[model samples]
Target: MIHWRVSLSWILVWSCSLLVGIAILCFGYFDNMLSHFQQLEPSKIEHVTQAAAKQETLPRLHSSKTGLALESQAQKEKVPNKATLTYKDFPSPVQGKILRGIGNCYLAAIESYMFHPGEDFLEPEGTVIRATHRGKVIFAGHDPLLGEKVVLDCSQGWIVTYGCLENIWVKTGENVEKQEMLGQVGFNPGAEGINDQPQLHYEVRHGNTIQNIETGGSNL
Candidate 1:
C-alpha cells in the first residue's frame, strides 16, 4: 500500500509536468506564428504613401487686380504654453453657407475620407473675410494647402486660423480688432474641393486641439 501510494504521487506529478510542458510549447508556437505574420515591411504602409503622392498640386494663383502671382513665406507662430487663458465666442468669420463642418466626412472633391478639423464655407471670389476675435496676428503667410493663411492668437487662450484665401491684409505681429478685414476669398488654387468654387477654411484651436467653429462654447 505504501509503495502503491508513492507510485500514484509520482504519476500525478509527472502528468502535471507533462501538461505544463505542452502548454509552454503551444504558447511558444502560437507566439512565433503571430510574430512571423506581423513582421511587415515599410511598403505595407503603401496606402498612406500612395494617398500623399496622389495629392493634387495647385496652379499658380494670379492676383486678379495685379495679374501677378502672390509671393509669401510660411511662418512658425510662437504660442504661450505657460499662460492660462480663458475661452470665448468668435463672431462669424465670413458670410456664406457652410460647406463642411468639423468632423470626419467624405469629401467628393478629394475622392477620399478626410478628418476635417475645421469648418469650410462657400463664397464667391473676393468675398471679404473678417477677424473672428480681437487678437494679434501670429502667422500671416502662404501655405502649400491653405493658400493665403492668417493666424491670430487671442489673449484668452484661443488661436484662430483662416485659410484658402487671397489678398491678405494683416501681417505678423500686428494687432487686429474683431471684425477687421484680414483677407478675402480668392482663387484658392490650393482649395480642398475641385468644384472651382471659392471656399474659406477656418479653424479655432485652444492649445493643440481644434475647437468647432459652429458650436457656441469651447470643448477644450
Candidate 2:
C-alpha cells in the first residue's frame, strides 16, 4: 500500500508539469504573432501616408507646368518683325471723320509749326478698339484725362494708344498681337472738358514723337 501511494503522487506531479509546459508554449506562440502584427501595422501606415502625399503634390506640379507652357507660347507670339503695313489693311475701332492732328510741338523759344504729330480718329461711342501690332502691353490702366487707356509698345519705334475706353481687357506687361481686342471706346467726360463728345481718341507715337496718322499714309 505504501509503494502504491508514492507511485500515485509521482504520476500527479508529472501530469501537472506537462500541463504547465503546454501552456507556456501556447502563450509564446500567440505573443510572437502579436509582435509580427504590430510591425506590419506600422509598415501599412507608412505606405498609406506616402501615397496620400503623392496624390496631393502631383496636381500642383501639373498645373505649374501648364502655366509655364502657356506663358512661353505667349512670349513667342509677341516677337515683332518690320513690315510695311497700311491702315486700310489695319482695322480701325472707331469709325468717324478725322478730328484734329497733332499740330506742332511748341517749344518755349521757337514757334516753328512742324508737321502734325498724331492723327485723331473720332468715332462714336462704344467702338471695340483693336491692337494695331503684335507686341507686349506696356500700359493698360486709367488716367485722369484719358479715362480708361491702353498703351502698346510695338518694338521698332511703334507705340499705339487707345483712350476713352470703357473697360480694359488686358493688364500691363501682357502679350498681345495685331488686331487683338484692347478694349471698348466710351465717352470721356473730360475729353473735351467743356465740349464733352462721345468719341474714341487714338494716337500712334514713334519713339518720343507722335506720328501723323493722315500724312504718315496710315488712314482709318
Candidate 3:
C-alpha cells in the first residue's frame, strides 16, 4: 500500500510539470506576436508622417508660384502715358523780349556754374509769363533769392519751373492748362531798386534731371 501511494504522488507531480511547460510555450508565442505588431505600428506612423509632410510642402510651393505669377502680371500691366507738350505753336509770355535765344545760348554756362538745371530769360519787369504745357501746379511759393516761383509737373516726365516772379496767382496742386498765366516777371533780388528789368528764369526737368528747354520750344 505504501508503494502504490508513492507512485500516485509522482504521477501528479509529472502532470503539473507538463501543464507549466505548455503555459510557458503559449506565453512565448503571444509575446512574439506583440513585438511584431509594435514594429508594424512604427512603420504605419512613419508613412502617415511622410504623407502629412508632403501635403504641407505642396501648398507652400503652390503659394509661392501663385505669388510669382501675380508679380509678373503686375509688371505686364504697367504703361507709360502720353506727352503733354508738343514742339509747336507755344507762344512766349513776355512781350518786347530782350532775352531771345537765352535758353539756347546761356543755359549751358548757367547750368555749369550754379548747377542750375534750367534757362534764364532776362525780360523787362512785369512781363506776363505763361505755362509751357498743360499740367498741374506742384509748387507755388516764394524764396528770398528766387522771389515768386511756380513749378508745374506735366505729363511724360516733364517739369517746368518759372522763377523770379513778382507775384504768384496759382496755388499748389491746381490743374493748369497750356498758355495759362502763371505770374509776372520781377526784378532780381541783388538788383532790387538798382535795376528794375523783369526777367523770367525758366527751367525744364525730365524726371528730376534738368535738360535744355530749347530742344522743345518753337521758334517765333
Q: Estimate TM-scores for all models.
A: 0.55, 0.50, 0.48
Cα lDDT for residue 92, candidate 2: 47
Clashes of each: 0, 0, 2
Against the hidden true structure, what lDDT does model 2 obtain? Answer: 0.71
lDDT over C-alpha atoms for residue 169 of model 2? 92
Local accuracy of candidate 2 as per-residue lDDT tens digits, 12-85: 99999999999999999999998886778777979988999999999999999999999999998998755754
Off by over 4 Å in 1: 1-88, 106-112, 217-220
- What lDDT does model 3 reach? 0.69
lDDT of 1 by residue, 89-137 (tens): 6655776898878777776655678677678889888899998778999
Best by TM-score: 1
Instruction: Record all residue pairs in model 1 with backbone atoms less than 3 Å apart, i.e. clashing.
Output: none
Model 3 Cα shift for residue 150 (angstroms): 0.3
Model 2: how far is 16 from its true place, Å? 99
Put the candidates in lDDT order, highest first.
1, 2, 3
lDDT of 3 by residue, 116-151 (tens): 344556777777788867889989998654568898
